[model samples]
Target: MFNGSPFPVDAFPQIIRNAIYEVEQHTQAPQALIAASALGVISLACQNRIDVCRLNNLRGPVSLFLLTLAESGERKSTVDKLLMEPLYQLEENLFEKYTHDLTVWRNDEAIFNIEKKSLMSKLKSEIRRNKDHLATNEKLKVLLASHPKSPVRFKQIFNDATPAAIKDYLCGYWRSVGIMSDEAGTIFNGYTLNELPFINKMWDGAMFPVERKSEPEKLIRDARMTLSLMVQPNIFKGYIKRKGDMAKGIGFFARCLICQPGSTQGNRQITSPVVSTEYLPIFHQRLMKIVNESIARNNENDRLCLRFTVEAEKRWIAFSNNVEYEMGILGRLSNFKDYASKMAENMARIAALLHHFNGDEGDISLLTVEAAVEISTWYVGEYVRLFSKPQEFTLAISEADELYWWINNYCIRLKASWITKNTVLQYGPNKFRNRSKANEVLNTLYSQNRILTEKKGKTVFIAIAGSIF
Candidate 1:
């Protein structure tokens, strides 16, 4: 008989935000795979003294080809220790220190003080005001595009979207992590702890407008529901809407948020800059794998929070908010939520840097959530920034390195169903071309068109594609 109605629907948006935070607490699938591969490549380069050879020969295509050809080391006690031991030791030491800081998040006094802040008050108000609007089953595309305050308000909606219990639970986990500093009170820098949407938009770019072609009303409903589920009790600690100051300091660390081939260029703070659709799922898949692994490793229970997963998908699906433009300057950007969510993920990395110094697991976790929020924000901001500053990131690289970067970074880790649908390996050359072959793959993964399939069948392919877990 118990349901989640008593909680404000406005708060629901924050829950959807958990996917972003959970992502921050973890890594993206592609990033991890590339990082691991990079480690291996870098290791070999260092060992063989082939650094110059690797770097010089590193074109995108060659890099990818090399990845396939790279040899693996045997399981030597010393070899494993030499490579993984140090990192594991570092993590253990860090975790030990992290637990001490977690006390701050756990204490009732600390929790109460955070909830008492000005940010939470405004967020609560925003939630009430926006509730009925979202309930109308109107597509977010038209509503966000047309609204003058779409950018800021949309964040509020998103920030407030998660459920209260889940938020509290995540907060609890942060407390468990115990990673905060005295000068900065908590590990998270700018995320007002209680702040709602303001911080989410500030460092990140504003939300972009786009047109929706699907069943508008249904999509909106699904989005809302999905977002709500993301922050439900079982997922990430409620919805953390703000990344606060911790997110702002790390803006200078990267290459480019939107590295499109042509058309919309540069890296400014925008929604989804137009990028190749071919690459979107790949990028998402990479991140999703990291998230799933983190969930499996961290959550006390085995079940992955439904709301968290849904929230992640919603981010990838948002027409104007989630995607970027690549070569073409025409046509509307894809889903908003999805695009914005990706930018938010990028911003979060900065916040995580700060939390790392605190040595608190709980605080680290909080910071992780905050960092994820920042990345999502960044993804969006970078999209917006592209229009004015086309050609922002001018880092030079050989064509081969670039190709490898794309393949290693995005392609192998894709999250969309089309990945299974279009693969040639499943049934030779006729795989994608043959409906039966493609369907066979789909059937193996999902339940041949049934509404729901066995839980085991839902492998969270996006996560598995790039996961260590």
Candidate 2:
């Protein structure tokens, strides 16, 4: 029921389009398929030190938190495996390379620790003996300071890790990393540990404070992360039910680019798998190119500052004005103004990604900006359709109210004071859906003193209070 066309994969590079196509051919889940590919690209882009647009002195990082909702049989895991295979391979390779260096560093660190302790003890002993042993204390300080620092493990991808763990990883390795998961329940369940603020702060590019009682001297700042999670709709709905307004109020869910793709269940046809393909090679090549660039920049401590061309800047302004105007109009996009307001920024990031993927230039083109605008417009429609309600009723109307209104109107039309439970189930409005839901509504009505329920011979009947036949 998502009332929008599928994401425009054609606007991206050919390898991405082909990869999506190949995955869709196998899985028959186009939305999840495309989302996985796009998330993969964004993950790589975020790993690189790159800024997308500089408009009015505001620079946006090409990082996004994307959430895809689908049912259990939607092949989300399959898509994830296919798209994230490269990152897994890269991680393995890095680990293998770092193993020997880590071993050497560990031995050196052990020796350094002993030396540092000896120096500290010597300094304390000198100070205690002389009370004015500044000369000896200074020599001990120099010895302690000359010890080699310990080695840290380098990591690129994390799956279902706590926010604090992720922060530590980012601090140790590259300053940026990606958090990806097929079953997003782990991330949602982490809220019990009160990790929302950490997650939110990371998304906003704010400084993170890593406090440690043992290492009070270490300071961690400017850590960045991107998130990609695919969850079932039922789990998402349950999360909303449990958290209520807190989810929206905290802007945690608002920062996500959410997509509820249509189900492809029961429509899959068996077909022979494509044997040899050029898509994977091309995909890996493009991805590795970006990964190499990011690694190079990280080594050199340089970040690419991308600026929009003059015409692209004009186009972006126009797009922003149109989005603002549409969101400002009552009943237009008022239900999802928060998401609408971020469309331009997200588009800029996407445009920057597209620009980088195509060429190595640090300039965004008008064509890319236009493509970003088109894609953002589609995403806005998706958001609206996902959250919008019909004019006759709002989401605020409770199921009990809807059922009560239906039953009251039905009895009044029939000029009857009472209706049997079977009749209500059979002839009530479609909002009831099933007898169980209808019974729940009936129980609510009876509990509220709005209706009278009587049971006789295994039959239940309900009558509206203050009603006349």
Identify the candidate with maximal TM-score.
2
TM-scores, all candidates, are: 0.16, 0.74
Q: Residue 184 in model 1: shift from native, Å?
A: 6.1
The per-candidate count of clashes, in order, stands at 109, 0
lDDT, candidate 2, 1-469, per-residue tens = 5555777767766656687777777678855446544654555555466766557868656777787787888888787777777877888888887897788888988888887787677778876787667766776678767766655566767777766677666666577777777778876666422577777777677777777678654444555667788888888887778773676777776677777887778788876766436686677677777786777677565667688999999999998877775453122454567777678888887787777766646478898888778767666766666665463534324776777787788888888887888887788777565876776566555545677665557776677877642
**For model 2, where is the 10-residue window of minimal lDDT?**
325-334
In candidate 1, residue 254 scores what lDDT?
23
Model 2, position 383: C-alpha lDDT score: 67
Pairs of residues at least 3 apart in sequence or in different chains that clash in candidate 2:
none
**Candidate 1, 1-469: lDDT as tens digits:** 1111111111112322232223222322122222222222222111111011111222110000001011121111222232233334444655565565455445744444454444445545657787544433334334434433211100101222223322332232211111111122221222333332322322232232222366232111001000100011111111222331232233311212321111111222334444323432332343334333433344343211111123332433342132343111111222122333334333332223222222223222432343345433433433443322232333322322332233234435563322222233343343235655433333322211111111124321211223332
Best by lDDT: 2
**Candidate 2 wrongly placed segments (more than 4 Å):** 1-3, 112-146, 191-193, 212-220, 360-362, 390-469
RMSD of each: 27.6, 12.6
Q: By how many angstroms RMSD does model 1 differ from the true structure? A: 27.6
Q: What is the lDDT of every predicted structure here?
A: 0.26, 0.70
Error of 2 at 350 (Å): 0.5
